[model samples]
Target: MSRNKQAKRPKLANEGFTGRLRFFVGRALLNIRQNAFVNIVTIGTITLAILIISLFMLVFVNLEGVANDWSKRVQVTAYFEQELAPEELATLKSRVLAIPGTDRVTYVSKEEAFKRFRERLKGQELLLEGITTDVLPSSVEISLKSASRNSDAVAVYVDRLKKVPGVTEVQHGEEWVRRYTTFMNFLRLAGLLLGSFLVLAVIFIVSNTIKLTIYSRKEELEILSLVGATRFFIKAPFLIEGILQGASGAGLALIILTGCYYAFLHNAGNFLSFNPAAAGLAFLPPVYSVGLFVSGVLLGFIGSATSLKRFVSV
Candidate 1:
């Protein structure tokens, strides 16, 4: 159908960029409809690949969020050698804030410390029957910056806090901190390896599928070449078609992903001990969602450009 439209328009005619692009897009749509089965198969395969990629990204993003939330709660507590005066506590807090990797400092008085302990032993108030405010040590809670959350960094920060005047000792969950950092590192590495693998796999699938489409239309391409059509002119419609297929597949994949995400949220409460929503489970953020669209466009362009290289000369 587009061949007939081109017959009257001639190959050498300058139709301008926008005009030619419009023609190419229209022709690409017509071609896809004509080869509906083949195009559907190609699009379906790509949709599945993109879906897997999107799903992996979703899980990784939420896991990273949960990790960040937990990591923020990791703090270094410094106990005072003796109870300090009001002015002394303020001065101590200011000095601890100046320490390397410190984000914030909160001074908990002996009274508050006992209060917290009492809250912890809510039902077992008997355990705190004789414990007085004087028995509890006043302490400063030093929160580390995000960059210094790792086990080694926390240990270094704790050591620095210990040297601060008036601080008798510092305690951070050293044992579990190392394990937590290790697990976070492993999660990051696995995400990188898996994401890269999925991206490469999808690109390969798209490239090969386009090549198949090219082979199916080989004769028409040969005819266009013999008729003196420029490489870009001859390749334009196919490139457009590839882009359209890629965009369609990506949209479909994202739609399915959103559906599955909502479905999981709706059902997560039925079987889980904890509330998924309360645990910080969430859909991909707006930025990441936009990235998927951009990724789709670039992937389409790459697949078509690569396929054209083998079939169309410079």
Candidate 2:
């Protein structure tokens, strides 16, 4: 009998953990069902907040992609002097290649340049009818390495290229690059500020929703407190409820985001002329999707905890 009682003790201890979890989860669902209208309002608010954040993330990610593409495309064109010898041109190529950030240098012959120009104006050959290959300039197109494509790095290369012998002109669109960089920086800052505001708004909405839930169960909580229930026992269900609310809201938001993504993809051709989608815009990556879901759960838990701190006196 003693051995049997000891064995039963371990079994009961194991059951206690599972039993507590079930109790908390069940109570959370019960509360949600009992306060369906309020829960719906809270969840809807969270959905809106998360959806706005997701849209911003989508835009930010794609714009960042476009910026990177533009950065990679930055090139420095060095037009050579009209009567340069082969040896001097070869020496010039070697010198340009020796620069630290130089990725690769392509020498475009005058004839090749003329051919490219003709191809560009294929339908309107009349524009080039009077043009000769000698009228075009033989230039070296310098593509910078990925690590050296920024404004400062490109400026260093531009200064170096200007002093190179046999080069009559060096062109790098410094003004345009600077303006683009500034625009992207402003966009990033705006997204961050807007996201922060939306998160705070979500917290406030959740807190108020939980506060009402607490009020509805005020008498029950007071009774439990008087009956000597531990603080953890009293608060566990509310915390769980908050988590559910947040997770459900995030799930809804993700569904909406997915729908929007597919819709955008389906109708992408219509907006191709005006939008970045023309250049193969993609949805947020998997890691960011997971992050959004985690953020939602954390936000809900935080909001619930804040409300509980005010209402749960014990």
Candidate 3:
């Protein structure tokens, strides 16, 4: 190359921060081009790993949405043995609202309760023929906060409600809530374990793959070391290369994930749910997508650093 053409190869050992950054980016790109096959393999491996983890996240995200939807049904009803005056009812509503984890307080008069019962037993109107408003209890229906819908929190909330004056009894679906909470906890634990394992596996794979590139350029690194190059100068380009590979892998994985998600929806819409039109299939949320991208970048950074520790000590 002519001197006026300015090759970056001769300027590796010394540069300012900005110059160093430019050099690192150029070198990373150069390395990727020169070792195109190895870099492609590394990026492909990263993409596969990211895709698997993202698929798991998509399922888990949908499950969490279902859980939140069901949790909305977790209501606690405080029944009164005798009917209360209008003022008494107002006072009770205020007190319940003041309690922690109370999302809403709905007062159900005896007549309203009777009407609801009748609606539920629509065809069995005969069952309610003799029943009057006095036959049913008037109650304050307490809808819980999202965070307090779990069994333990609901139990504590019920205990507090029972202590309120005029409350004869408090009832929530204890057994159902207990079972649901157990299942949710188990799901979270399993996701955590599996997610952790996948992340570590990808990092390991990337590290080993990067090691191959390092081995191929062993002599070049040695020459840079003898020429008084800083360790960071030698490591920066490889680190940047890893970052690029990681980011590209994540982007490609997301593209593939989107394609698969649409394909699933297209086919499943014909037969999947009882109401296929409202099957509610969803992709990863924006927050989860951000997490995936960050995970990819992290995978690359840690992997490249690990591989460079023993091999590139300029």
Candidate 1 clash pair list: none
Ranking by lDDT: 3, 1, 2
- Candidate lDDT values, in order: 0.84, 0.82, 0.86
Span of ten consecutive residues with least summed lDDT in model 2? 5-14
C-alpha positional error of residue 1 in candidate 2 after TM-score superposition, expressed in Å: 32
Residue pairs with clashing backbones, model 2: none
Better of 1 and 2 by lDDT: 1
| Residue 243 lDDT (model 3) | 93
For model 3, residues 193-276, the per-residue Cα lDDT tens digits are 988997778777767877877777778778888888889878888889889988998888999998988887777756655542
lDDT of 2: 0.82
Query: Model 2, 55-140: lDDT tens per residue?
Result: 98898898888777877778889997684678988898899998889998998999889999999999999988767899988999
TM-score of each: 0.90, 0.76, 0.90
Report the C-alpha lDDT of model 1 over 212-254, residue by residue, as the tens digit: 8777778888888998998988888887887888788888888
lDDT of 3: 0.86
